[model samples]
Target: MKNLFIPHFIYWSLFMTSKENYHKVSILLSIYKVEDYLEECLDSLLNQSYHNLEIVCVDNGSPDNCGKILQKYAKKDSRIKIVTLKENRMLCGGRNAGLDHATGDFVCFVDPDDWVEKDHIKAMVDAILTKKDSLGNPYNLVLNRNAVSFMILADGSLKKMYDFGETSGEKTLNDVNLNVREDTEVPMWGRLYRKSFLDAHPDIRFLEGMNTDNIPYTFKLLAHMKRFYVIKGEENATYWRRLITPEGAITPVVLWKNMEIPICFDNLFDYLKKHHLAKNLRIPYHWFFTICFPRHKDQPRYYLRFKELMKKMEDTVKSSDVYKQEDRNLCDLLLYAPDFFNFMERYFTPVPVRISRSRIKLFGFIPFWYIRHKERKVYYDLFKIPLFKRVKTDDKEILYLFHFLPIWTRQTDRQ
Candidate 1:
């Protein structure tokens, strides 16, 4: 009777716990030459408040002691699973290997050189489970804030010197608009993804054999997402990203590799076109035009292959209905302006006039007093004057400006 009861109890426990109630989050880490920091990274995940986690680490032929360290952790905690590769396959290849091995209800990424707060996994899991879109669908992605850390030689430790913003509260968002906005952060870390959603779109894997491979991969995810959730300042689940290391200093720019920027853009463009989601071109095209296209002239082959690619991009932007008239004019200067002027003027120019417009609002509404000014370069300060002016206030006046001369104006408490 005791033996029969044991089997029945095990079956009952399994039936009681449903996948929806308890989600298994797989934290994927690609192990490379991070032996010095590997232990701290592993410990952070192992100590996470969230218990149901699969820590998948891909040993991408690290010449350092990372492999041995991983083995040591795996023995202590069965949650740490390791996948060994014969040779170094770069970041894309290593992450792809981990993604293939991960078996969890939700998926996330972490850099072996970086570490997360103890509640990182738990915070993300709670937000994703409780939050739903307008249509009552679960969020496919969730983004959080992270801290940028720098190494300090005084104690040979990482110090958090900077914090990223835009994560104040929980909110539902449209991902395409977020991607198009210049302020949005695109790094894969500090985010959570639904495993089933990723499995449904198998082609969204990172493109291998390229530097800075996340551009195309992330753009694809943003374009396809129906809606995503963002939870800020929750349980201090910040991803601490180490910017400087002893041996891993930043690399110098390579012209040939820079050429891949357009290739990445085109890859995203073609994907959207093939799927009949060409309307989403605004996401990639915005970055290509504003950020990537301006730097193309620096390439030595600007006249050869790069020029042709720019023309193709210009045509695509011209044909798209997503851009406003201002964007089209900027593209015109990019393609038609002389190379030297375009390079210096576009790159070195301060904030354009359009972005510097100022307005006075009263309690976040229209103000009683108004002043209109014209735009001009700093060199032409003498010629600068108000384009128009309007005043509609009952307050006592102290002084005011009529055209270029001051006639009367007022000092008010509200002002």
Candidate 2:
């Protein structure tokens, strides 16, 4: 009456079956000085729904407790691969080191300071491998198409997601908002890469020391990759970039701390030219920078940078293989001179609202408050804060070997 034999057979069957279908994934995480958030990041990776993961975490020689925490996790989970460097190689080099250690069929990048959704890897690997029998599309890359950013206040508590709004499905190269939104979002991470494709296109690595490294990586994927399989909705594949952490992040614009867009574009032009792809990507490539013009035109040194930006873009467009003369002229005008209607956007752009920590936690929705500056122009910097939203989500395929707040399941603590 106990029926012990049936249960024994089922247990053995599952054990044997799971062993038979192990598709390994290599997670490449680049670490610098992420001591505060390192534990959360590792927990998410080590406890993914997919058990067959080889996490290659490279500590770019962080001076804090980051390396120690990583070593602790590595000891606990044999799946974790740790690489320690004596000197910080910034983000790109650190990732390269991890890439060198990757041995999985598919590869993914995760910043050590960030956390992902519970089903993030499971969903991404599913999208990349597609139906399994065929090993997915094998050629094109797969993306979650959306990512979330969380600002860790000075006190180490989060104020929820940064209300950038959300759009589902693939943000294709052809989409008009691709440049604008993708740049704001962590465009590089949140996607799974097929090892075969990356191996073949090995040169498509992140540009070391380049501020706009994503441009080259993204452009290469756009030009060379076969197609995209975008994962969205219930199968959410996204990362939470912990902005305003202990060390904080560099602000973009107004004073132009690192306005390297044009410099990066120059490199792009040269790369496309060397590879003979310049002719075809002229307009689309040019649109990459101009899409953010209206938003950036109100900054302190807007005109200073905007002038150089136009000059560089114009050069690339002129040298491009094919383009209508009229189109080129229009491109020059938009690049060289903004019309009155567009120029006046400086006044009406709501002075680049910088919602303080209190403002964000207090308000349930995104607020628009105009500010008055002492300067004559009275303009606000557009890139001050990220546009993100607060949403409630549940955990998936809970393989949570380690339960940690800020690791996929923790709900936003926004007031």
Candidate 3:
């Protein structure tokens, strides 16, 4: 039984007197077998524009040289705190251990393998400190831009970056904001959390040994927030993530846990119900059926397990009173005839096309005009102005408005 201790009281006593540390941000880095990338990750935090950062790295019993690397960094920088464990506790357990020693007013989780921009902490802290929810209370969460995953190719050149975190929208997240997939509903990283708020809700801890922990943790956290703030445009900092390839998507252990998402979701719903929290599950319902299950539905090795677990999750989703009949109907459609649902979702789904003056270019790169039909009328716009007059026909098909770019624009129907 190898034991390691953190002298938290002495450290806090020395730092608490400084007013500059009032808005201190504690970054929790859960280190396991990431020695190769650990130094770069630590360097990124050390170079952060936010000087008031507290970097808490938990060496989760990593057998590699991660412990040595953490110690090396800690000796050079007082802001770096090290927590060691005897064995691997997985991501959630490691972060939980880090949280116990975190003394920052705001907390953020950064993977030891991933690095962030220099201004990431500064951007997050600045927004969270100055902003407040509708009720004039500070938000429990502050979301930054989506993380882009990058990888180095054989030639030492970077591969094309792919964006993760399927969400976007308003500056402040509300009920409607959550309806569309937007940032911070998932992924523990790329966001900032208030330590005091987290302390208030003891039930919000991450479920150890769970691959799908972030989903339920995020959902429950959102319920307590009056609203959360999203940093948009240039002001927001970017989280540069390293692309990770799964060893095997359908490995026995991975498959078993993948199938356990429903159980995790069930446990989440139970917790929500027990505490009487608002149970808006739009994200969870769609994410499970549409995203999680569908990914494994096509793999032959995992199809049977996927179907069985999907049906179980469907039951949990159906029991929730917050969902409407249409939502339940969709869930049934997905479970019974996934092929038909996929076809409909691919072709019949209403995908909004956003057009604005700023997007149009005169060099013919982006079309200066857009045309669509509606009820025997052809609505068209050129450079955001009506160029054609309305034409009526005796017999014509009624079509819905398809193009929406409102900028001093007029609609004219033409036969």
Candidate 4:
């Protein structure tokens, strides 16, 4: 009788192990008041070719018909699990809620407003399972696909793939010889991630009061991953609906809020430095100073805060060998905009610059008119060259010349 009981227990344990290994992907969705587009999003997810998916939907107090829709889907599909929050939590909160409930080998976050290709999950899973790295460890892949470009009306089905090889703004889906970059970092929705990686880095949570910007969280997540996969093929996956209309989904104005952006940037910079990633952090740091910092000038307190933040960044970059030159150049450009800088200096010292706008404008237009004179030059100079090459070399001179073209032509056109 003892021998019989031992074999029975062994048999049951082996059965449970087999069952656990069968499930592959978990689709983690964070839903709010997206009733208009939620059905399409659900439909795309439900129809994925990879059937071993567990759907975890977190509803953050949607006052719309979203609750009913989620309930209906949950009832129909046993795989769909719904978690309704008591109060309206923000984007980060909703995602964390979903993360807590997820129990799959791999995870993908899909915004309720966006839809994915039928084979999106299948392609991503295949890449992760089959692909091997230099050390023979399975590649911890983050798979990204192109987004469709239709905002309000779902009728205009636009499918465009990102060609990483083409220059930042120039690459379109139509280009045949597009040289795509292998290691481009993009927003969260475009990719599928390994769940184990996320489990290892529990501290990588999204900022609650932030404008739902995924870059900070996504970058931190990707930095920890070993390999990145950019899937470019007939897969034609992930439709990112561009809301073109004024009344469509508006990006949150937290950047314009007093002290929000500077604090966020400062936090991100410190995180990078602590992790010994200050060099890679320069691009986003420069971007924040150039774009978001200027918007705060409308408010006095925020404007002063922006100057202090800039000074702090300037000092930090100066002290580190990784960011000194790039930071100096960016600081020079900010100083050149006197009216803007003058407003900023109310709380800090103004960095001085001698060049006037008129002289800068003159040299700027020459390259602009010259490049636009032919399509080849436009393609080669504007799109073909990598961003680092342009940022580091004579490309600034080219950029300066291009800047003047608009002002020069504006005068000509007015005449």
Task: Give the Å error, residue 9, model 1.
Answer: 5.5
Candidate 3 local lDDT, 1-415, one digit each (tens): 1232346666776688754477888999888888878898899999998889889989998999998888889899999999999988877788788888999899998988778889888887877878876677777788776467677555546664666544433244345334545643336778789889899988777778755546567777776664787775655677887643343212223334355555556666677667765344443544444554445544433344334444655755577665666556656654675564464464246645543322355786766876555443566677666554333455333333333433333344553
Q: Of the candidates shown, which would achieve the greatest TM-score relative to the real structure?
A: 1
Off by over 4 Å in 2: 1-22, 131-139, 161-172, 176-186, 235-238, 250-255, 282-415
User: Model 4, range 222-329, lDDT digits (tens) per residue?
Assistant: 445534555655543554544433244434355544455666666666676678765443425555545555565356565455456566566556665545465666
For model 4, state the Cα shift of residue 43 in Å: 0.9
> Candidate 3: lDDT of 272?
67
Model 1 misplacement above 4 A? 1-22, 146-159, 168-186, 234-236, 246-257, 284-309, 319-330, 338-415
What would the TM-score be for candidate 1 when compared with the true structure? 0.72
Residue range 175-278, candidate 2, lDDT tens digits: 42234354334456666778877888777676676435466566665666524556656446555666655346533431134455645555666676677766
* Residue lDDT tens for model 1, 1-415: 9999999999878856955336888988887888878999899889888878899999988998999999999999999999999898877788899899989999999888777878777788888888887788888887776445555445676665666665544342233444453224535667789989889889987767554546677667766775677766645576677644543532122222256565666677778777866565464444554554445545435323434554656765677676556556655655675774565476457755542334556577744334343342111121243433334345433333434444556555553
**Which window of ten consecutive residues has the lowest lDDT sum in model 3?**
247-256
